[model samples]
Target: MDKSAMSDPQQPATVAILAYPEATASVVYGMYDLFMATGRDWGIVTSGEAGPSLLRPLVVAARAGPLLATNEVRIEAQASLQECSSADFVCVPDLNIPPGESLEGRFAEEVEWLRRCYAAGATLASACSGTLLLAEAGLLDGQEATVHWAYCDELRRRYPKVMVRAQRALVVSGEGQRLVMAGGGTSWLDLALFLIARSVGVDAAMQVARINLIDWHAIGQQPFARLARTRQVEDAIIAGCQTWIAEHYCEHSPVAAMVRLSGLAERSFKRRFQLATGMSPLDYVHRVRLEEAKQMLESGDDPIEAIANAVGYEDAGFFSRLFRRSVNLTPAQYRRRFGSMRRALNAGV
Candidate 1:
């Protein structure tokens, strides 16, 4: 799959989408539809005539047969790993594997095939947890990548050589910039559009997006991330403090209050707190306060200053800056993005 051939208008780019039992059917079929529509749908929508097909998408699995995918959806593979030797693009859709589970002993054949495809000059793209396959195949080593926010920690833990950009919606890295990865949820739409724009043209990609009414996730994943609750630790003292702080996070000098409640020397308590929670006492407090602020922003109509004060920050400017750094959005922007949805749900209720 030469780059020139992919860019040529006369030849359609072949995209092989890898599928397995754990794969999500929606992402696999959604990308197939988008790629298949690239150059063909625009003409039909505008001029009442179908245009030339710019991309040929085929679902490639370990064996050519029907397999049940996540949520009990049946997916038919058009080709097997041995049959599909090479293509202009290789796409791995989201897999329904748990973030903390080991990927060892899984997708052995598919991983080997991906390595061969990359060696043959095929561009590799993954959506969401599908990036795990590329990482497991060692294609993402020493390259920047991103996955769904929940999987970011596990990706970094397993592949220390890969730089994890958890806040980005999309990342393009690796040799010749051929590896493309999308972040959580529907960001695969971004990945598909990027590949289309790169291979065919930006105009074709834009036309497809318009036809599908796909909204680009430009703000990235930070705004959508919820702070994961700290798991219960073996240290009873620290665990009790955690429970106390969750309710008293908006109080003055919450860390010092926790130290007083722990009944340990201040320095010893801070050391033990970090060891147990994997975060400094002050950082933990900020996380709790920010989590509360996010809830207020989503569920209420409070002003920024009022929300900041309620979240234990008297200085509204400092709160605003900290919120922007942590959540990648100001209070108003967070409200605008999530408040409407909250209101809509409330209205439905």
Candidate 2:
């Protein structure tokens, strides 16, 4: 397709969503439902006006048969890979699996299909673990992309050429913005709105958001991420340091103490710590402190200074700055947004 044909304002663009085994049903069908409701549903319901549909969304399966989602929910493919000649946009949603699990030979044909579509001028987009497929297809080589936070390490390990931006909500790469990636599982919504705005119009995307009541712009995965998620390690030295840090994170200069506990030279301890946990000793201590501080902020009425002192930071101002950088929200803002005895009580906590 020519550039002019792609930019044509008359006809609705074709949006093909890929479905495969072990995919999350919510993401697959939710995308179809959201895009399908775009221009037509909003216009008719809002003012009884029939607006031109902005997109032709279809679920494409590799085989010409039923596809089962992770929970055994079955969906028949509306179009097979052989049937889809071309598309303006292609979406790959998350496949429900552990982050470290290899997807090497799981969907070879789908990877090739994605490559063929991209070569034929389709803009490719992926959400959550679906970025794995893009990397497997060699589409993301040497390009900045985002993946779900838990999978960032695995993605980097598996494909050393891809630049993984774990913090970003949506990343657009390639010349002419032909490649896009959305971070986290729910970021598919962000990707959808972004594509709609870029292809259709900002007004159309906003209209869809309003109709669906989605907080499209205000969400990113950073704030919701838990910094204390465990990593299994075989190194006994690093394991002991991890346990020590968790128990003594409130002490001053915990990294020095952890290094001493490791019974190795400081440099060797730092190297081994990073190898085992994918973070520096100092970073691990900071994460431990931040995790505790977050719990205190959510459950208690302590002042910021008190929380800082409890977390081993003497300077509350410095702690606040670090907290903002790490969590993307200030201490006060975090408490106000997440803290609330009333809300906790309502949830039966």
The total of clashing pairs for model 1 equals 0
Q: Tens digit of lDDT per residue, candidate 2, span 1-349?
A: 2344456778678888999887887888888876777788777878998677778788889876787878899977788998886889999999678877788888898999999989988999998889999999999999999888778888898999999877787899986789999887788888898888887788888888888887763545666677634644689888888877778898977888988888999999889888888888888888889888988988889999999999999999999999999888899988887887546776995
**Candidate achieving the largest lDDT:** 1
Per-residue lDDT tens digits for candidate 1, residues 67-126, read: 999999999999998988878999999979877788897889999999999998899999
List of clashing residue pairs for candidate 2: none
lDDT of 2: 0.84
Provide the overall lDDT of each model, using Cα atoms, as 2-decimal numbers: 0.91, 0.84
Model 1 gets an lDDT of 0.91
Span of 10 residues, lowest total lDDT, candidate 1: 1-10
At residue 89, candidate 2 shows an lDDT of 94
